[model samples]
Target chain A: MDTAQVFGALNIIGLFVFAVSGALTALRNDMDIFGVAMIAFVTGVGGGTIRDVLLGSFPVWWIAAPSAVFICLAGAVAATLAQPLIASRLKTLIWADAMGLSVFAVLGAQAALAAEAPAVIAIFMGAVTATFGGVVRDVLLNEPPLILKQDIYATAALIGAGVYVGLMALGLGISPSAVVAALVTFAIRAVAIIFNIPSPKFARPRKTEL
Target chain B: MDTAQVFGALNIIGLFVFAVSGALTALRNDMDIFGVAMIAFVTGVGGGTIRDVLLGSFPVWWIAAPSAVFICLAGAVAATLAQPLIASRLKTLIWADAMGLSVFAVLGAQAALAAEAPAVIAIFMGAVTATFGGVVRDVLLNEPPLILKQDIYATAALIGAGVYVGLMALGLGISPSAVVAALVTFAIRAVAIIFNIPSPKFARPRKTEL
Candidate 1:
């Protein structure tokens, strides 16, 4: 497939995975079905939409295609319906979420470039598009953003987008470049999760320090 | 004053008001001092900064000037120290917030216009900038966004921005148009609050509905 086709397919997959991530978080947070769906939609698409607007691509993704909305709704409903059984498998969901995050980082930069964004902007947009929605979701749920807390989330996106843009600048064909970028990101995040890579530790405060 | 100057003044007043509004909300929620300060800072300036970045203004407000951060911190400290006494006088804080919201709408539109945004985009930015941060604060605290539930919040911003843009398009001076817009918005909101204006009632479920 060509670059456009590769990016499009990956983007859809990222959206679905992103929705699943949001639904999982919502489930853990004890949100209702509607609440889960709303969180899912926002988590899956909010960052990309923000990036697009910043880049002046209006009508936004969900507005441009109702299918994304429909799919996100279905995912949330499925999560709610499966909660009784699925809660036992949160480990699996986290890995899936990491994969989703990686895909989004790669796809985001590609989309920005296709939309004619500058290279540095494309990389930043990629990271923001991949990760900030989860931050929003976490903040709304009263959790510190995923970026601030745990394993290599925003950094993974940043590196992945940077690599993709760098490769493109080096005149590599877009499809191979995208595949390498997505795979590298996915490997990094998936290995981190699967092998239980520890996040950088915050300094421990003594009880009397405060 | 030019459009930029009008927005600059409104921004200063808005900084104080929004900080107070956020700190007061945090106080009512019984957050600790640090939590209160954080909420105050984010709610005071977060929305407009987000709007500005999405509109391609870099460094955002807090990053551009450290003073805005100090103002929010001071507001938080003031609210924290005074909450025991101020709790009984909640309406005062509410009125102050309403005033801030009105001015934020005017300033939001003016900022967008100064950035040379299209009129329609400016109006949208006005609504988003005035209403989004509070919405973020409410959602983070797990409350329904005020615009989704109560008085005419986003609607008021839209109306004011529309009026301002209309006047300015007719070659009216910026400050005069902005002042008129802000005054009209503040009056509408103040009157509505005094009269206890509400959104249209949701259809109540009958005895058999459940």
Candidate 2:
């Protein structure tokens, strides 16, 4: 497959995994089937939609690609059917999320570069694309966002996007650059998951007396 | 003021009040000054930004209008300074929030109509525009979303948007339609607040035995 085809396939994979994760969250929350589908669809598209809007990409990406919506629904259905099997396999789901994060970080940065955004903005968009879907899902479920609470999630995406931008600036081919950057993102997340690293927290001052 | 200028002024008011509400939420959560400002800015712009994105309006509104950023910051600062006074008077803040919600509901539907979206979509966009900012703020703060829990919040926005759209379809002028719709929205919210009406909840089935 050519570069476009490869990236397109990876994007579908990202959408499907994100949808499964969202459906799982909805099921855990005892949401009805319709709510599960809605959450899954939102989680699948939310990040990329946000990135496209920020970059001023018209009509958003998914509008022209109805297949993406179908993929998300398929993921939701699959997850629902496999709920019992997956319930005890949280680690596997986390790993799948890492895959989605890594791929989307590179794709998001590529999109920004295509849109001629500044490198800094591209990197930020990469992190946003990789993380915001989960953020929206958590918010809808009234759970603390894993993006804010987890170790090395958005940070890993940011570093990976930075690496991809640096490589492109150095004249690396797009395919190789994307592969290296995605791998870097996955490695960082994997390490964090394995070591159970804690995210840094800022110290807040105590409430002052009135 | 002409119609554009009148709507412009009301939009600014909406932004300022939303920012104040966000800043208040941040303060209650014991966030630092910078965090307060960030939340205020997000709350001020989040709903409109979402509306613009979904409508494929490029660059979002705030990027072209730097004044909006400054207004949000000003609101944050004002709220921070007046924290004690506002804390003692929650009713006033609620009324101010109602004003913002009413204005935004009309404006959001107007934007969608301008984009030539279907009437149903326009009305839904109106609700999205009025409530998503608070949804975002509550999510960021790990609180239950008022949009989901509060009485007649998004419903008021939806009905108001429907009124505006319906009036416009019947050949009413923009200014008059906007005014009538916003008043209707505000009246609904005010009634809900006064009566302490409860939001409708869907009855969920009990967990099935494994």
Highest-TM-score candidate: 2
**How well does each candidate reproduce the native contacts, as fnat?**
0.03, 0.20
**DockQ values, each candidate:** 0.06, 0.14
**Lowest-sum lDDT 10-residue window in model 2 chain A:** A84-93
Q: What is the interface RMSD of each candidate, in Å?
A: 10.2, 5.8
* Local distance difference test values of all predictions, in order: 0.74, 0.83
Q: Per-residue error at A141 for model 2, in Å? A: 3.0
User: What local lDDT does model 2 show for residue A98?
Assistant: 86
The C-alpha TM-scores of every prediction are 0.56, 0.60
lDDT of 2: 0.83
Judged by whole-model lDDT over C-alpha atoms, candidate 1 comes out at 0.74
After TM-score superposition, what is the CA distance of residue B51 in candidate 2 from its true location, in Å?
2.7
